[model samples]
Target: MSDLKTEADSLNRAGIKLSYAADPLNHPLADFKSASHDLSAFGVLGSLLKATGEVREGMTELADVVTALHDEWQAEGKAMLDVGKVLDQVDRLLQESLARKHG
Candidate 1:
């Protein structure tokens, strides 16, 4: 698979573990809305990595996801910035991680 897809897979797996550890049953947002929602295979892996502290290693994965999603939006020559709400979630997750890490 492409690097983005690989990273996405990793993030989905890790995110699930993190959610479970954080008490998904109580935290409504972090937990995927659907039981079959395979978050580890999620497209916004980079943001999820940052949100889950995986960014400390490096930002390659996050950048890849962002770029791929960005490309997807522009593939049809639409030049759009947002696609499938991935960018929105990535922004929020990254900001939250920054606050928790440095602030």
Candidate 2:
């Protein structure tokens, strides 16, 4: 139905936007990792550096999860679109067959 198609379109668009948003996180994550490494060279901030490392690890994990979710949503959207197309075709065929029988 049109509702299914609409939902599929919405998911696809949202996935695209999510991809764009996740992309910016990569740059910042890289920068944070680099900064964390740079902070490690200083001896006085040992405890702070450890905390930074942990935070960086957590950020990396979060980014990975977000990227994975984006991929899943995109795949789901494509699958939904495919299902909608198949259903539409079947409906059309049924309608045609009925018309032929009635005519």
Tell me each candidate's RMSD, in Å, in order. Answer: 24.4, 4.4
- Backbone clashes for every candidate come to 3, 0
Single out the weakest 10-residue window by summed lDDT for candidate 1.
76-85
lDDT string, candidate 1, 6-32, tens digits:
455555555444434423233443232
lDDT of 2 by residue, 67-103 (tens): 6875776566566556656666666676788889999
TM-scores for candidates 1 onward, in order: 0.23, 0.60
What is residue 93's positional error in candidate 2, in angstroms?
0.6
Report the alpha-carbon TM-score of model 2 versus the true structure: 0.60
